[model samples]
Target: MKTLVMFGSKSDANIYEPLKSRLLNEGHEVDFRMISVHRSPELLERELAKVDAQVVIAGAGLAAHLPGVIAAKLLIPVIGIPCAAAVGGLDAYFAISQMPFGIPVLATAPDAYGSAVDLLSRWGRLDLQYTFDSFNIVMERHKRGLPHFQMLLTRAQAIVDRTKIEMKISDRPVENALNICLVDINEQDPEAPMPYGPAARGSDEIRIFVPALSEQAYREAYAGVAVIRRVATVPGGIWTGINNVGNAMLAALQLANAQGAHAAFLTNAKKGYIHA
Candidate 1:
């Protein structure tokens, strides 16, 4: 199947390119166009008429009416990708999603290329679903405010040990090995040897300290500990501490999964952090 990717400005290339690459990887012929609804309406119409595609992925920022306009003119499946260029893309999202009754522009998140591909797959054209090596294991430390310290510690340890044993049996090299990161919600006591557990110090483990949402909280909780600001490169095969651990497990898991980690264990609770 062929897919057409249309965007309002050249800056939208960042969003368009990735989707185009993914579509091409899924064995679909993709054509990209940098045209606008306001500026080049005639040219856009002419180009749209000429393209031979089964699906159209249109994106726009600010008002973000490009997708709606495309959907109005064309009969093919139009998937709208809102660009986060203005007002955190919410303006674009509303404009794309809240369309008139007759015209339907299927809208999704700003960077939701997989959803776009899934739309195609449902149409019985292409079969493309992206998956990473990192498997997520969610551990709830608390529902409202009940501390499950031992439970968190126990589950974390089990996952770590099991991963290590499996890796050892597989005999994968250190460079090509898997890793685990601790997304601990509120394990207080900075003096504790290993916050998550002793296994956290293992070569393949990363400790994610998501205690506080702000720098002030982090400084108060982790006084002497070296809390990573944004990102850090570990040269000595060490786990770096990332502070945004509340709902940032996905980001951490992406890193671990990129390195071929088999599973990512996360806690699904909103309890207070463990403090002294």
Candidate 2:
């Protein structure tokens, strides 16, 4: 509920104002201050001890060590927002990002305030969260023939569409279009009857790349839906199948990024694909 935001210089106030306003709007206590690590180390330390907060976000430019220093002193989570003060902020970003073990600083670009907000929102689970396992679990759940898989597909479509528009992608489908492949459960297990048929359930709105064998059947089965006969394998087992999907999503995201598209790619695990 309480957040302590420290900016290294008064000149960086413009960068801090929006984040401060966002936290205030969310009805959280935001203590904003300008404390330089180099100029006023003692004052910064004294003020840090005085402040009581659930999370601390520090902004610094040019060899930014404020967030790392804050993390070194406090047990609470520290998020670093690298300012574009020197070398377009790359120097500051590396400063906080390359913290030694036992001291962890969450690094983000100065413009990515939303990333900080998201971290703060889920600050309580920061310590307990296993990021790799979390991603694997998402894939595992999808393999059980659950609805989350369909949800992920829908979210991926939205991301692709938004990115296309933002990047001025042509309406005509080209070789460069982000290809989204869907697993053919029936093909993988011919004996087992697929409840949703060729494609997964609730996947009516999005484009799905199907295996060559079941391409015609899926097209006939689901009218008005886009289905492609692309080279995609649907290996047996829940984990293997899910890994295939994750790989496909990652490929699509990479293509989108390569095309200079505006994509949030991994906004949330339950909602969209996480770029892990």
Candidate 3:
């Protein structure tokens, strides 16, 4: 598989270098470039217009719009890495993860080689089985704290009940199971050994983080789950407020099923709720 790796600034080399090297070592072609969306919008547009690659990986910090801009122009999947340049990288994380509807970018942690490789594996470029094998052992030893947010729990449960998908709320992940894990960032302790225990267990599981008001909590959780199978955020970001647990659950369900179902689900969900 051929990949085009782009970053906004040369300072982001530490984040994207390992990723590029790993891709090359795995016998995949990589085209690396430094193109800032804000500074060189015209050049970025021109380059993306004729770029020949199956996937595009773009990294940037502080208002990280490189990946979104690439995604807006390309038909291929764009994986975004939010470097920790400002505000513990939460600003870049939100900017990349919370992209508007229709332009989808797979936002990931600063060290996101595993997610990128996993995505390529899913696309038939590599035969790697799983990336979080070590995480499983750690997750098995530690116990997850009981959920603290009752209101969010009730909302998530209602979403699962309505969808008729079997919901299991546990600290550890089930091996080889096709499940969507709903994690409430607001209920986690920053000092906990493994705050993202459930999400670390397997590559088949999808994790949806419920919105939280604390910037510290968000930063810690995003760093904790460095290489989960997939990560998703609430639809409207902060505008959805802290009570968008239901939206997170819906996102989980949407990811759990076929991609074709997303449009229909969004249409229905937007009728009364989810302005985004």
Candidate 4:
């Protein structure tokens, strides 16, 4: 049976390329699309209406309203994938299953291509007893998917070819931070050796400013701390008020402008030092 795997962008393809190949060998046709139903509803609906695939896997990240839209428009079985990230794929997952009434979009998990295949098997897409062998091969390969099967390198690389991060800080300690969060702090002991610095080493309502969003890099700021807290802000609110990390660093600069902070220092992620 032919199956279509539509996505919103090329990155979405990167998200599930391996899985698509897996489904292909199962004697199921796989299709991909980058059409935006919201942008071109008539065209999208027209194309989707023609597919009689046994199962359709739609992938999207961030505002992942694409999959649910496909499911709502048809009665055919749909498999949804929610691309998880550092924070969470909550929005993406919700977008697929949060149907108004009768519309339904079945999903597995973060990178649950196995679930999609499993669901198709239950639907009797392929003979289970004899065919599980082929599926087993796929599973074997996946167990060793990458070199380090145990570790998943989700640490988003420092955006390659990214320019330096320049930001302003009222104090020198923050001069080193661009896009940062206090993930942990040591349990303070009254007798613990205290490093000399600003009178109040740890203070509430810390302000971070950037010359531009480009300087805002993602990283855990604090370490060995108790009662870790995160400030309420949008995904890319630290850099910009928009969405995603693309223009986040640039947005950070705008925020700095609003707060009247001067670009006093720049860092390139190698050595935590200041330059004139």
Best model per TM-score? 3
lDDT tens string, model 2, 82-102? 787865665665576555433
Q: Give per-residue CA lDDT, model 3, range 90-178, as digits (tens).
A: 67776776655445566665445556655454434212122221111111222233343454455555555545545555555555432
Q: For residues 1-276, write the lDDT of model 1, one tens digit per residue.
A: 678888999887778888788888878888888899999999998997886776788889889989888866755557787788875665676577555433446555554555565445433321111222332322233421323333333434443453342211111122212223333333244333332321222233222222222334444534323222111112121222223221223223323332234222211111112111
Q: Name the lDDT of candidate 3.
A: 0.54
Which RMSD does model 1 reach against the true structure? 14.9
**Considering lDDT, where higher is better, how would the candidates rank from best to worst?**
3, 2, 1, 4
Badly placed stretches (over 4 Å) of model 1 are 125-276
Clash number by candidate, in order: 2, 0, 0, 13
Q: Show the lowest summed lDDT stretch of 10 residues, model 2.
A: 231-240
| Candidate 3: count of backbone clashes, pairs at least 3 residues apart or interchain | 0
Model 4, 1-276: lDDT tens digits are 567888776666657787778787776777766777667778888988798664577877777788778866655545677666424665565455444323345544454565565445433522322322110000122232332221111111122123333222121233212322111112343223212121122221111211111111212222101111111111111111111222222223322322223122112221223111
